[model samples]
Target: MIWHSTGRSEDGVMCHPVDGESWQKFDVDYPNFSSEPRNIRLGLAGDGFNPFGNMCNPHSTWSVVLTTYNLPPWLCMKESSFMLALLIPGPKAPGKDIDVFLRPLVEELKFLWQSGIRIKDTATNTFFMMKAMLLWTINDFPARSSLSGWSGQGYRACPTCNEDTPSYRAVNKVVYIGHRRFLDADDPLRMSFKFNGQPETRPTPRHFTNEDIQEQLGRLILRKPGKHPNTLKENMDRQGFELNRSKRSIFFELEYWSSLQLKHNIDLMHVEKNVGESLLGTSMMNDKSKDTSKAREDLKNLNIRRNQWLQKRVYQIEKENSPEFHKELSALSMGSQMDVYTYTACIINGVRFMVLSRDAQRKTQNSGVLTVCENGEKYYGQLEEIMEVQYPYDYSTVIFRCKWFDTGDIPDDNFISIDTEKEAYQDDQLIYASQAKQVFYIREPVNHRRNQNNNPRCVVEHVNHQNIWDLPSDNARVQNAYSDSVQDVDNVEVENVDIVQKDSSPGARLFIEFSHTFKAMLT
Candidate 1:
């Protein structure tokens, strides 16, 4: 029980699974409301997924899911915990009619927010009044408008910065170019991109931010949607119920989550999918793939310029003179001429360690060692996995894929993410140490079967010892437990794991014997 201390009594905890410093921002930002552990923060997510494997069925399935950030790292992710708010079956996409489908869930949420329900915390074995509040809605670009009560297309598309989105007349239809307003006048991003070689004419009212249009407020009022400035007053004339009656979503009334600038964010994977598909459609010369997208005369000019740039980088200039070439050169570690890969230390079994990529050669194995949790070690458990993009890495990443070390700690903040994979702790995942301390990976597993149809992931087999005291302390100790050469499911060389000491002591040892256990605990 001493070694398994949950740190509930400690004042010095940071990234807590339930109520650590992770939720401090939301609480600190709002001084009017006192921070309490029982108040739940959550996010509503909805996506139209096809239940049928084949498109021949031709039906869309839209399901609303709510995730709670009130659970701990261990049990926060169990599928049984995920609250299925609603299920909307559709022969066609819900479009604007989606509000009718979301009413019941919203009403239930309204009741829960106003009058909390009695709930028991199994982890601490206590009963409490559990009041929940919606944080924001999560969805892909297509589903953003449907769930968040906002238009996702055209100039009025941006949920946070309404109508400030710059636009240019493309053909006959008005096409919104990009978020020209999101950039500063002198920002490098302002020059990074341009529409048809012309810099976007900056948005009017030059010094404006998302706070101008979107705000978290107490009242959710019905209004005619779109770019009109006087939308609230316009709703007075239009009096009806259901979809026709109100264009504004019931979500605006939550009162707690009203402050977020962008409530509805399109999933990045969908953006990547669109880009990849478009690039694929553009790459091939054959006519068979011609239907992938409409042919555009403008694309020809774009391709011509891209080709010219590629040629200049490849042939026209010396490699020493190119900035991009120099960047690649800088990627190589000093003396280790081969490219450098990075390793971010992840806390595993309360010990700070990192799994190097399988492709890491002995020479470049220790190339770019980034030791987090070395001094300021972040807590790891079923929760706290992050996937980020880094240079020079195709599959290189840090997986927070480790176990809950029942170190003496308890989160004082009632913050946990319920949107987690059940087997998150079991598999190897890449992660970044972010302040969020969110329980689940933002995306799916690295090698999920659905993601890579050709190469199905082999089921991972883990050897669970009865107690942490019995777990391996050294490579030899680990090899003793496994019959078939201490290998992961992927059959990589995991035997070379290096468990460096996290203690800041000038000369500390790895896994010191229990001889000093009593003294250490007393200290």
Candidate 2:
């Protein structure tokens, strides 16, 4: 385990947390602590969840977990290795009071960092004083504010950007903008008029350093725990919006906190979920979308995107006033239209089937197959066209025209292999759409790839069509059928038993009869 933790992979890929630069930096800074590989490196994570499973209860529970990064990457993340350091039960999240609950854990970590603990190394059969470090804290956005004592909201909400965070009021919410500032100076988007109708000539915001953060945090008044959130807002407004630091984070109490490269890491899962939901909602223009009527109004107020204003644009539609439009509307209302509808695809028995013309254009074919069972004989074919015949009383029925494969020379095998180039039953082309079943054809691999015409045989595979809202039946029929020449082996075995018993001696005949009876019972 020690070798695995300290070694690199064959291709030099990072396979464990020890390979990270932060670990190396810590090791270089604290040579005495890095001397023993057995010393554990831990990460702290906390989140609030509902224990009752009923959201209406409004009760919340926060679990503080510690992960040991000394083990192999595969084993380190497993639940078995996780240490539940603390569980804070509540009718509401602890918020700023979380530091009060974290005090004991912080003191223990400080003791481990200074005095250390003596333990027996099971692998080495020796005792050594082991020390550990609190590498970082992981939490979602809201929990980050509680854990780090930093405001995750307001004009200067971003911790990395500090006072230079870009934001503006858009209708009812704060909209963060100026992402183009991070792009290359020569990039076309820097001069694009589509966004805010102005070029983004501003440079990217500067990242805040640890000393700068400490200086800014020292000037702020720490709000007492359990106070109304509005009170914190009032205090911040009084102090001014230039600073987002609420208080010195409780983590700073640790001796090595300032020395660590990253003290707080935002959980990626929550960020991904939020970004994905916003993208999908906006693209689909659903109720969850941010692109609302008021948003367009705001854009118009900004004197940008004149074409996308809420005002309707007039379009010329000469057909709407044409005489033919009234005639078509009357026919549709009366259900007396004489026109026949030709469709490229249709669904039958919960299976989608498409005509050959439409299916040919696709890379993967799903609807071209046509299979039918008539007079106890199964026929394989490809769909040619789908037509709907309408009657005067709004009655209609669908018909399918297909081209069938030749079955006369098909080999006697378990799989139905047919010559793709040959056609059979040409005169018998049309069938009621209800009789058709969906299927697909797979061409057999051959040595001559460049000459597909030389390898014309294709194996038939049937598709199972089932209702969406129904459970699958235990006794579903198998689709594969055996050729007529391959007789049932069970019947052949029974005939052999009859022939053997007739020529056997009396004792042998009695044994044969008993065996036959046993076989029949087993069947």
Q: Which candidate has the top score in TM-score?
A: 2
**Which candidate number would show the highest lDDT if scored against the true structure?**
2
Candidate 1 CA-lDDT value: 0.45
Clashes of each: 18, 0
Q: How far out, in Å, is residue 210 in model 2?
A: 2.1
Model 2 accuracy (lDDT, Cα): 0.67
Output the lDDT of residue 165, model 1.
45
Model 2 residue runs over 4 Å out of place are 1-5, 9-16, 228-238, 301-306, 309-523
Output the worst ten-in-a-row residue range by lDDT, candidate 2. 511-520
Candidate 1 wrong stretches, greater than 4 Å: 1-25, 29-34, 72-80, 123-125, 171-174, 179-184, 187-195, 200-246, 284-296, 299-523
- The TM-score of candidate 1 is 0.44
Backbone clash tally (model 1): 18
